[model samples]
Target: FVSEAFRVFDSMPEKNLVSWKAMIMGYARNGFCREALKLMYRMEAEGFEVDDYIFATILSTCGDIQLNEADSSATCYLETS
Candidate 1:
């Protein structure tokens, strides 16, 4: 489903904030935290300003992965986004 979701997401002509958030959250919920982080980066690269909810999702995803440097990673994510 995640892969399918990505396929659909990639095919979209003009992605907005909501779609990006859904994809990121879906990846995180499905235990694909790394993918979620990557998507967050991609979302920013595409000029989508991640909102507070998305930030929370990223933090939660980082927590799911038990990242040792969650704070630093989040700082980097925030900076990039």
Candidate 2:
């Protein structure tokens, strides 16, 4: 399922927030926290703002993985979100 999702996502000529949210949530729900977070970073790099829903999902996913509190990127999101 994830692989198929990745294939579809990769093939999209232009991805919007909804498509990114779906992929991120799908990965997080499936125990792929790392992938989800990676996508979030990529989303930001592409100039997509991580809204509240996406932010909450990411926080939950980070909790599940026990993400390091000292990680600068994580701290930045925590502070800004």
RMSD of 2: 2.5
TM-score for every candidate vs. truth? 0.78, 0.79
The ten-residue window of minimal lDDT in model 1 covers: 64-73
- Candidate 1 overall lDDT versus native: 0.79
lDDT per residue for candidate 1 within 1-81, as digits (tens), equals 899999999899999888999999998777777777778878988998877888787676667435454566677766764
Model 2 has an lDDT value of 0.79
Off by over 4 Å in 2: 65-73
Model 2 lDDT, residue 70, Cα = 21
Top-scoring candidate (TM-score): 2
